[model samples]
Every structure is written in C-alpha cells, then in structure tokens.
Target: MNFDLFWLFRSLPAVILGLTIHELAHAYTAFKLGDMTAKNEGRLTLNPLKHIDPLGFILIVIAGFGWAKPVSFNPEHLKNKHRDEILISLAGPISNFALAFFLLLCARGLFVLPYFHYTATGIEIINLLVSWAVINFGLFFFNLIPIPPLDGSHIYTTFLQKTNPRLFQLVYTYGTWGLLLIILIQVNTKIQILPIMPLIKAITNYCITLLHFT
Candidate 1:
C-alpha cells in the first residue's frame, strides 16, 4: 500500500519475477503443446524485458491486477484442441502457485538459518523472498477466479463445454463483469471478503509454522 520509494524499489524485483513467470508458464505450456506462437515472438525466455507491459505493470503495482503481455497461442496447433488449450491457459496460474510455494519453503529455510549462524544479508534475502511468496500466491489465487481473461476461466470453460455449451458461452462472454467484481471486492472494501486473502493468510501461517517458533 505504501507508494514510497522503498516499497516501490523492493517491489520491483517481485513484480518482474512474478510477471515474468506468469507469462513464461503460458508460453512454455503452449510450446510444449506444439504451438510456436509464443516462442516465435520471443516470450519463452525469463528475460523480463520481453514480457513487460508498461501500462499493465504500472496498473498492477497500483491496482494489483495488471497482466503481462499475453503470449500468443493458436489452440488449433494443439493435438487435442479444447483440452490442450485449457491446459495452456491454466499453466500460468499453476506456475504461480508452484513458484509461491517454492518461495515460501525457501523463506522458511532462510528464516531458520539465522538462528544457526546466517548473516544479515541472509535475513534480508529471506525477507525479500517472503515478499515474493506473498505477492505471487495472492496473484495466483486471485487470478484463478474463473473469470474471462483469467486462467481459471479457461479451466472452468473446458468443464462447462462438456456440460452445457450455451451456459459456458454466457459465462465466458460475461467474464469481464466477473473480473470486475473480484477487483472491487478485494480492493475497495475495508473488510476483505474475497477468497484470496484467506488463502494467503493460511499459506503465510503455514510458512511460519514450518519454521517453528524459535
């Protein structure tokens, strides 16, 4: 919430890493599924410059909902068109979850290391890593709300297609509203009612529990 230089400075690395991984997951998933759209556009690598969306990045830091420039994917190239497309789309959020968990475990290790003789730098790195975990996990969970333009929507879409095609279309078409509602609930209200906040709290608590009370 703090927009001071210190917060912005520390948050920059986390934003870059978060956004980079978010896009890379999609590109890599598509590439693995036989689509070269993302790779051809040079989005498969970890170089943050390639995926940065200037406006999105700025809004993301401010409003906490910015996305990276989307990686191109032609679902037609996938062997199982519908299934693989859903997988490719779902990959981004899944990767964020994985990264957040990895960072959490890493932070726990750093947190305990100081008691065993780690230096100040080690603790500082741990702080940064914890920030990364919190940010990544929040983003991951929030983005998977089954709204249009979000990975969860694609995942949910695949399932809906099998049940009721018309309903699926309606949901997908109205996804913008769903997304907007998520933003409003989580951002505007002083009392947080969104699912994401609780999940983040549980994850953070788990990290602390893992390290033990020293």
Candidate 2:
C-alpha cells in the first residue's frame, strides 16, 4: 500500500482536530450524564494525544475512515443507563457534524475576503478549511456504522440487549472481530463492505450548496 505524503501533510491537522473533538464530545457527554469515569481517567480535555489511536489516525489519513481511542464510562454511574448510553454514543458524531458545518461556514467566509485569492497563504488556509470540513463530515458518518466499538453500536446494542438478549450477546461478543474482518478484507481487496464515501461526498456537497445560497 502506497502512502500519499502530500495528502498526509494536508490531512494531519484535520485528522487530529476531528478525532480529538469527537472523543472529547463522548467524554463530556458521559460526564454530563452522570458517568465520571471518563473525567476521572483524564479524558475530558481537548488534547489530541489523549484521544488519538495511532493505528486509527494513520488509517483515517490514508483510508478516509477510522476512529479515536474510545472514552470509557461506567454504565452503573449513568442516571438512565439505556437512554444515556444512546446520547453519549451519539455525541461524538453529532459534534463532528456540527464542527463540519461550522468549518464550511468559515471556508465560505474566506471567499469574500479581499486579496484572499491573491496570496498563497490565504489560498492554503481556505484549502485546509475545506479539507477539515470534509474530513469532519467523513468522521460524522463513519462513526455511525452500527458495528462494535463504533458509536452506532452502542445505540442499537442497548436496545438489542433488552429485546434480544441472546442476539445481543452474540453481537457484543463477535461484532468487533466482524468489523476487523471487514476492514481487513477491504484493505486486501477492492470490496467495500461498508461503503460510506458516497454519503460523505453527498453531504459535503449539499452543505457547500447551501452555503452558496447564503
């Protein structure tokens, strides 16, 4: 597998910022929902070092989809276990989406600046802003796949645990392995077990279009 050095250079900032914010959102939401585990573990910070998983970071930069170190929380401490779990799980993706929208607006704002296009620095900044927005959008959708260790799994598995205990046990036990297998297959071959690029591109384009009218 060949790595693109230029792509990595441009994507590093977005990857770090997006992953940090995503995990921090999880930690903060869990803390707010009465789980102090993440806070006690010193995860309620904006530091990228605390949130980034090395392999995930590399994969995201190269493959456009990956994850951060998951924020741990004690379910026993949560006020409403099931409902709060869903909210905590959702916080990461929601925060990424919000950040993406904000970044898009910032990028749009750059277009109106006088002399912005004439300067190399301004052009690079705008490009970075757009890249950041799209990367965040990718993070937003990627984390929502209902596989284990991802945010979406928690939401669905919470309900599954109640309605189908046996099935839930199977999923909870094997989902991570299944997710890893799918990733490995994609890495080795051309099959897209979880095709998400189209969704990411569609949403990013839609947001850009909306910004154009504003």
Candidate 3:
C-alpha cells in the first residue's frame, strides 16, 4: 500500500472547504426558495462541521470523490415545485464552480505581488489555492452526475417524470444502487468509466489561460 501523506495533507482542507460550500449553497437556496427545513435544521451556515459526512469526507480524501451531508428541503414549501427543485439542486454545483473560479482569481492575484513569488510561503499558498480550486471543480462535476441522490438527478428525474413516468420511477428507485455499482467497479478495476478528469483539466487549463497564469 502506497499512502501519500503529503497528498492527504493538501487535500483534506480542500475537500472540507468544497463540501462545506456546496452543501451550504443547497441549504441557502432552499431557504431562499421558501423552504425552511435546511435552515431550521441548522444547516444554513458556512461551517464545514455541519456539512461533512465522516465516511464521505474520508473517501474524498483517499479516493478523490465523495459526498457531503445532503440538505433537506420541503418541496411543498416551494413556490414552484419543479422549477424551484431544479434551482435548489443546481445551487450546489454552481457554488462549487463559483468557488473554483474565485480560487483561481486569487491565485492569479498572488502571482503579481512584489517578491511574493520568491518566498516558500507564497508558493505554498498558491499551490494550496490551486489544489483547492481543482477539488472544488471536481466537486462541481461529480455532483452533476445524473444518478440518484446526486444534484443532477433532480433535474434529470424532473424532466423524465413528465416524458416517461415508468422509466422515471425505475431510475428513481434503483439509480443509487446503479451508481454504487459503477463506483465499485471502477474502484476495483481502475477503469475510467466516468471520464470526469478530462473535463476538470480542461476547465482548469481554460482558467489558467484566461488568468494568464504560468
């Protein structure tokens, strides 16, 4: 077993930050959309402790993919169930993307400071920022996978419920198991079935280009 302690040290905070922001966005959006369940449950805050799931956090640290505690919302309280549900589901991923971009911008800003690049601390800060940005980007895309219990599933199922009720019911019922199976297979076989890294790298490269970072 080849354990990388340095990777763990760098990724732990990034994972916590990403998960915290992602779940908080969900809770906040639900609150804004007239659902008080998340807020009433004391989840509408930036505190990572409220959002972190122990096993999930551990998995993300070791496996590069995992989940946070989900925000609960009452769809009945929403003004428009379908639209508001989609919006609430979208909030998590959107927040992660926004955070990633902000992190990249922060990194870009750090590059121009006088003699900042000459110090070990500056380089470490920039590396941490970039790592955090990448983790947030991963969270953004990973949550958007259209499987049960993921954010994208709400959007997918909402539309599918109209066109094909039976199919939608089937997916809604068993999609989580399917997702788990896929994950298990990938873990054991080391196959890149999801192909999400390419997208993350593309986005990172695009941000780097736009920010003129070396």
Task: List residue ranges in candidate 1 displaced over 4 A.
Answer: 1-5, 114-122, 158-170, 191-193, 211-214
Across residues 1-214, which tens digit of lDDT does each residue of candidate 2 receive? Answer: 4567888888888888888998999999999899899999889999888998888877776765567898998888988989999999999999999999999889889877888856999878877898889888888887899998788898789888889999988997799888878877876778877877788889988999998923
Tell me which residue pairs clash in candidate 2. none
Model with the higher lDDT, candidate 2 or 3: 3
Worst 10 residues of 3 by lDDT: 57-66
Q: Name the best candidate (by TM-score).
A: 3
Q: Output the number of the lDDT-best candidate.
A: 3
Q: Ranking by TM-score, best first? A: 3, 2, 1
Model 1 C-alpha lDDT per residue in residues 120-196, reported as the tens digit of each score? 77778877887888888877887787777777788777778779999988887787666667675666666565577
lDDT tens readout by residue for model 3, 94-191: 99999999999998899888889679999889878998899899889988998987998998787788789999889977998788777767666768
lDDT at 190 for candidate 3?
A: 63
Query: Candidate 1 vs candidate 3: which has greater lDDT?
Result: 3
Instruction: For candidate 2, report its TM-score.
Output: 0.90
TM for candidate 3 is: 0.91
Worst 10 residues of 1 by lDDT: 109-118
TM-score of 1: 0.83
Superior candidate under lDDT, 1 versus 2: 2
Tell me model 2's lDDT, rounded to 2 decimals: 0.86
Clashes of each: 0, 0, 0
